[model samples]
Target: MILVTGATGSIGRPLVRRLRRDGTAVRALVRDEAKGRALGCEFVVGDFDDPASIVAALAGVDRLLLNGAGALPADGEQPMVRQQKTIIDAALDAGVERVVKVSVWHAAEGGRLAEGAHWEIERHLKASGLSWSILQPNGFMQNFITGQGSFTADGNLVGAYGDGAVSYIDCADIAACAATLLTGPPRDGETFLLSGPQALTHTQIAEKLSAALGRTVHYVSLTADDMAAALISQGLAPRFADDVAVLTQGLASGIAAPTTTAVRDLTGRAPRTFDEFLAAHHEALAALAWAPSR
Candidate 1:
């Protein structure tokens, strides 16, 4: 059986559905019983923080989809490292045969935030002696709706990109890639850099949003230091604010500027475009602060 973690997340939700459509035996590991039932699939109640629950979840499971929470505002520490490493260790003990993990683009040692944290977890997965495929995905187009990336209190798009483009990918595409890797022939230790078909600046993104919403949307550009100062002034932890600020500064030089064929090569189709993403998620984006309040 293939066990999926983070089964309620943007990528995981669609992955479960696709796998079910393909007639794959899938079990979602969820912390909440209600959320798991809402996934409309077989599920096991578990949390990465609870090792015993993970052990229970991995029962009779041969393949594991290892994904969960992401980084948070913490000083020189990454909770993701501890959490996923725990899962890896449990997967090892549970006799799981393979693991497919979701990692960040530019995942390397000494990189900041998710980059650094994912690198450490990837290393652990490799050393665990299990068949593994790693998907290093670029920015998620859903970030705009989730408010995980750049956004103002009034819901205007905000960033330090300085016109540099990012090949933002759809989370559904990422899920499709993971499903392909898990169900197809083993690609042990293979890492795929997943991206969309093209890069777009935040200005272009705002324009697309405007077109979708039938209202003028704006992109506010700020320097890295300026973003940091703004965060500090807003009472965010200073160290965490500076780390994010540094990452914002690096984006001005085009971090995810190039598109890749990993999605097509894995899923046998072109990745979805930004316009398609907006169309698929129009309702969520329409609920942003810039829109007419419910």
Candidate 2:
């Protein structure tokens, strides 16, 4: 049986749905039973924070998809890394055949916080002696709609990216890639850098959003301090907001502005464009308003 963790998240949710549609037997590990039941998969109650629960969740599983829920803190307990080690340990102990993991682009080269954690996880996975594939996808297009990259205000797109370009693949494309790797032949110790068809800057993204929504939207650049303050005002922890500002600074330096063929190479088609993502999520964008009460 195939096991998926973080099954209710952006990629995992769609991954589970696609797997079910493909008639694959799937088991989902969730911290909440209610959410697990809603996924329409064989459900197990577990949290990566609890290694015993994670071990219990892996029973009878031959293949595993390792996905973490959020970015790891720069200095802390490193919950994501700990959880990944726990899962890999359990997988090795259980003799699971293949493991597919979601990592960040340039994780092996490593400087970003997420990249560092992924690098460590990749090292552990490789040493586990199991067939494995690491999917290192670039920035996600869904981040734009989810308030991580940009937000709408009177039909305007506001973000900290300025004019820096990024190849943002849709989360569904990431899922399709993951499903292919999980269900296909065992690719031992392979890494894939998934990206969209083309690289786009914030201005280009705004234009696409404008065209897709049939409204005039412009991209407004914000200073890192300003962005951090805004995010803090929106209820993100001050330290986390500062880290986000740092990440945006890294993006602005052009580190994240590159295109890759891994998505198309694996999926047999080009990844979804920003316009495609805008068309699909236009309504949700239109309905969102910056309510400080949220």
Candidate 3:
């Protein structure tokens, strides 16, 4: 049996569907009973913060898809660093044969924000006796339509990327990779860097949005300092805001320029292009065109 954590999330929901369609027995770990039932698969209520719950959930599960919320404010520390570490410990104890985790691009020791948090968890997972495959993916293409990173309050394409291209990818592709890893033979200790078919700058992205939305959308560039201030204005801690600003500025240097063949190599097809992503998510993007700007 395979246990999928964060099963209600963008990647996990689709992953569960794909696994079930492919005839794999799957269970979702959820915090809410209703959510668990809605998954249409066997599921158990569990929380990363509750170690005992995890132990019970992992019982009889040989493979684990480890994923959860990203960096959150916790007295200037990333809670995921501790939260995922706890899951890693429980997975180890459960005798899970293999674990697949979602990480971020540019993840490394001492890297800023989620990069550092994911790196620390990756280290722990590697040290554990369980086999592991880490998926380090670039920005999610869903961000544009989901109000993740694409807009300012006035509905402009907001970013700190100064004409640099980001190889954004679809979470579906990421989920496909995870399903393959969980169901197939173990590719232990391997880290796959996933990206879209091509790199596109903020200007190009805005143009795509315009064409898709049938309205004029503009790219508004913010400096590193500007991004930090905006985060602070949004009630983020100043220190955390500054740290995110550092990562945002790093994007200006083409940090996500390289498009790797890892996704195709693992999933047996080329990753979706940005245009294809927009096309696949046309209705959602179109809805955004009419919604009130945040």
Candidate 4:
């Protein structure tokens, strides 16, 4: 049996569906029964914060997908560092044979935000004596639909990325890779760097949104300080918001511009382009276009 954490999330939802469609025995680790039922699969109520719950959820499960929420605005270490490490320890004790973890690009020591958090978890997972593969993906294309750190109060695309482009992989593609790793021959101890087929600037992304949403979506470029101040006004912790802005500024240097063939190599198909992502998520984009911006 395979256990999928973060089953309700963008990547996990698709992974569960694909596994079930392929007739694999899969169970989702959800925080509540309602969410478990909503997933329409075998599931257990569990939280990463609760060690007993995680141990129970790992019963009879051989392979696991280690995924969850990202960095939060809390002070000190990111909660995911602790949460995922706990899961790793439990997975080890539970005798799970393999794990596929979702990590972020540029995960390294002392890196800001998710980078540092994922680095810590990666280290723990590597030393846990469990067979593991890590997926280090670029920005998610779903960020546009969810408006996560990508939109302003007026619904305009806002960022510190000037003209540099980001290769935002679709979550569905990431899920496909996970499905392959979970069900196919093990590529243990391998780290895959995933990205979309092409890199796109936020300005180009806004134009695509304009075409898809049938509205004139604009790109509002800001310096790191300006973006940090705006995020602080939204009630984010000053330190957290400033860190986010600093990370965004790094994107301006084209650090995340390169595209990779990892997705295609794993899934046996090319990753979706930005246009295809927009098309696949048409209804969500429509809703986003009409929703109140924050």
RMSD of each: 2.1, 2.4, 1.8, 1.4
* Top candidate (lDDT): 4
- The C-alpha stretches of model 4 lying farther than 4 A from their native spots are 73-77
| Residue 143 C-alpha lDDT in model 3 | 74
Error of 1 at 9 (Å): 0.8
lDDT by residue for model 2 (154-258), tens: 546666776788888899999999999999877778899888888888888878877776777788788889887876765666666776777776787677888
Cα miss at 59, model 1 (Å)? Answer: 0.2
- TM-score against native, each model: 0.94, 0.91, 0.94, 0.96
* Residue-level lDDT tens digits of model 3 in 22-62: 88999999999998898899999989888899999999999
Error of 1 at 52 (Å): 0.2
lDDT (tens digit, per residue) of candidate 1 on 1-294: 999999999899999999999999999999899999998889999787788998999999999988875646435355789899999998889999889999999999978868888999999999888889999999888777764446676667777878789999999999999999999999988999999999999899989988998887799898888887776665556766777778866877898799999999999999999999999999888887364222
All candidates' lDDT scores?
0.86, 0.81, 0.86, 0.90
Q: List where candidate 1 sits over 4 angstroms from the true fold.
A: 73-77, 229-238, 289-294
Candidate with more favorable, higher lDDT: 1 or 2 = 1
From the highest TM-score down, the ranking of the candidates is 4, 3, 1, 2
Which pairs in model 4 have colliding backbones?
none
Regions more than 4 Å wrong, model 3:
74-76, 147-149, 235-237, 292-294
How many clashes in each candidate? Answer: 0, 0, 1, 0
Whichever of 3 and 4 has more TM-score, that candidate is 4
- Give the clash total for candidate 2: 0
lDDT of 4 by residue, 1-294 (tens): 999999999999999999999999999999889989988999999788889999999999999999998747455446898899999998888999999999999999988878988999999999999999999999899877863566777778888989989999999999999999999999999999999999999899999999988899999999999998987776666777888889888998999999999998999999999999999999987776566352
Residue 129 of candidate 1: its Cα lDDT? 86
The order of the candidates by lDDT, greatest first, is 4, 1, 3, 2
